[model samples]
Target: MEENNLIKKCQRGDKEAFQKLISQYHPIVHKFLVKITNHEQTAEDLTQETFLKIIRNIEKFDIEGKAKFSTYVITIAKNAYIDYLRREKRAMQNTPIPENLNIEDVHIQVEETVVNKLYGQSILENLEGLSEEQKIAIKLKYIEGLTLKEIGDQLNLETKTVKSRIHNGIVRLRKQLEKGDER
Candidate 1:
């Protein structure tokens, strides 16, 4: 059977069909994540995330559209990478710097200011690069943890449009992060 037909079957709650979809797309997902995070473990974990997300949201896949089902699944993988990076950066920051290092004594105020300024600048630049719809979708969905339907109601878009915007936003953010401007 054709892949799209398999996807349609999976969307309709066929468990075996879902497995076939996973088998076909898992490698593509892993490779996509490796391109973003450059870590084998991260890519493997993200591949699992992508498949799991697809399983959970298979009904949302537009098997009838020109957009391939694999594209939709990989988009989830890309968003997972962005979410991972943001979490990593926040974790790094929340770890307290050692007071005994005496680095704080020498340049405490200056270092803190520089770090904050750089971080702010990088985030602003990346946000500016995103489309208004993408930025809004990401902010609402990821930051606010709003459901897609809620986001749609708030933004006056279809739920699928909200998901697509969030997916596209994360893909663009992954590209930015891979460029190594980790501020």
Candidate 2:
């Protein structure tokens, strides 16, 4: 099911829609909890607690907001784990919960990371028209983190030529992306 539709159905209090939404995000929430708690059983318990809180508070989530549903789930999962830590009194036997889980700074970092990844993917998809030389040069410099001299040496070209290829490739990419934005 489409995520927006699922969210809308969930907002309208459909039990089945909430189940589907949980199915979509359960693995991510579980994985994140596992990382924080370092135990499958604890992660599972926290995951359930997270969703229960979701059931109680899902109505307050703004479907039209910039935050993605996954981000919301993760933030809730973190909060659940934090609550677990506090309730169990940190001295709880061998619990691996990190001492430094900061809920205050979680949301912006997750949102920015998602945005950067999707933005980078869009740029990569628009690499169709670049020449083979330009593509290799750009990738070696940007993706592979090679200097111009190193890229030139690898490609058996002069450093100036490598730099020019990368520069022109970026200019063309920029123009194409800008034109795309107009539509």
Candidate 3:
């Protein structure tokens, strides 16, 4: 297969092969990063980091009987995004509170946390009625903001399947919400 040949060439340190691979998957990975980070610059930076990791660990990549190369690369991208989030969380937590900061800032943070918690709980309660696949598709597409193709890559489904799952899941959620409103 062409993918197998590319993987072999990449493992053998063929920069052209590696470049080809990156060019092919960069959009998918960058789209995924944008969903996670919600910032174009951060997503771009993370995209580069993901490829660097892939280049460094190409030899460890198993092309046959393991996983598709796209899936493997997406996994790497997701892990990199998660690591970035964790680092950001830690940085925020370690940031010192300025003595001159207004009380309104603290109050705003508290309010935001409360709103997020309530919104998250409402979504989770509604999701309880969905099948696992539906729930995952909805979460990845709506909550994570991944495109259909990116979701397909992550879930190992075709883009059409991902679109169907997301559409059906949204319909179900809408019905559930309407029923709740009737009560």
Candidate 4:
């Protein structure tokens, strides 16, 4: 059956349709999660969670919507991963440091974490200054660790186009970052 028909069946509360839909999209979604999280087990958990949310919200998905179904699924997967990251960050914040750790060692670790956070924040801010096309390309390539071919497929662009965007974006970012450093 076509995707629209499958989605229609899913919307009508067809269990078999939902299962088929999951089977169809699970691999790409799982691969994306694995790339973004860099952890296979976490990717598996997030992939499962993403599909569960999809099952719950399938009725709301419009067959007439502009986004392709694949895009929709990827978006849901991204949001699920983001939510997981937030929960993990909160858990880290709430957890007490181990008593076995030396005070100076803990202090050094905390300092390193803070510096990393600041540098990461600056990169994110700079990313906002990029064109939407370049920003997406750069994030998928560097942050999510997706290959050029994967990014091209996801964005429906040529591999050459994706590579050019990433390279140019990085050059611009490097210039911007150097200016900031000099200040």
Candidate 5:
């Protein structure tokens, strides 16, 4: 059976159907968690938690104009991961930095950690350099997950104009990334 149909069955309180649906989606959910968490065991635990929440809250889900099953599951997984990060950050903040740890080693680790973040920031800065309409259009269409038509509606632009903005923004962002790589 299709996942959507299986999800509908599960939502209707069929235990066997829910179990089957969970089994099908478990690997996908785990892989996504692993990518974000970078820990296999933690990913497995989070994946289980995600499915448990889904099963518990499935009744609240409306099929009408709702996001796809995978998108909904991913949003839940992303939220759970963000919550985990917040807790981890709080715990770390409560701990004192060890004075005995070599400053050079800490610096090296920080550099490695920040390079990717810097790359992303550079791309964002380039996007911000675009015309206001282009930047807003791209952000609505890509970051906000709006369709081209939706972006057009929100921006009071033609669909083609929205598409052009997104296309131009993506091209500029790519160029920025490329220039940074050359550096």
Candidate 6:
């Protein structure tokens, strides 16, 4: 069956269609979650949660929108991972830190921030030479975690145009990084 037909059937509460859809998109969601979480078990659990959310709320999906099904699913997976992080943070905050751990031991946190800032600064410097469109596309796709269609909508451009800009921007960044390495 066509994807649209499958989606329609799933939306109508057809369990078989929903299962097929989940099977089709599960790997994509799992891979994306793994990238974000860096843990196989967490990614697997999140992937299942994403599909569950989709199954429960499939009626909310807009079939005629510019966003593709995969994009929508990926967005859900990203949001799910973010929610997990927030929950983890809240849990950590509620738990008391051990008295054996001194304030001096927390220097690792400051060092991590400094390292992140240095990398961020380097990336910003490399991005300076890119065209405005390229820069915006790259930032929206990677930093802001927006889909290509979402970025296109924001920039009033086509999806292909946004994708091209991101591709060109990445190439330029790679060349810049290589030059920096050589220096």
Per-residue lDDT tens digits of candidate 3, residues 3-69?
Answer: 8899899999999999999999999889877765557999899999999999999999877665788
Q: Where does candidate 5 stray beyond 4 Å?
A: 96-183
Q: What lDDT score is found at residue 90 in candidate 3? A: 100
User: For candidate 5, lDDT tens digit of each residue in 85-125?
Assistant: 66877998999978799989989987975685576666565
Output the worst ten-in-a-row residue range by lDDT, candidate 5. 149-158
Task: Tell me which of candidates 5 and 6 scores higher on lDDT.
Answer: 6
Ranking by lDDT: 4, 3, 6, 2, 5, 1
Stronger candidate by TM-score (2 vs 4): 4
lDDT of 5 at 16: 97
TM-score of 5: 0.53
lDDT of each: 0.72, 0.76, 0.82, 0.84, 0.73, 0.80
Could you give candidate 2's per-residue lDDT for residues 33-55 as a string of tens digits?
Answer: 66546579999999999899888
TM-score for each candidate, following the candidate numbering: 0.53, 0.48, 0.64, 0.64, 0.53, 0.58
lDDT winner between candidates 1 and 2: 2
The runs of at least 3 residues in candidate 4 whose Cα sits more than 4 Å from the true structure, single-residue gaps closed, are 103-139, 142-183
lDDT of 5: 0.73
Candidate 4 to truth, TM:
0.64
Candidate 1 lDDT, 1-183, residue by residue in tens: 498788788878999998877888877677656644546898899888778888898888776665555556656776776777678879999999776777656698777756775676555457657875687577667655779986676455688898999899899987885674544
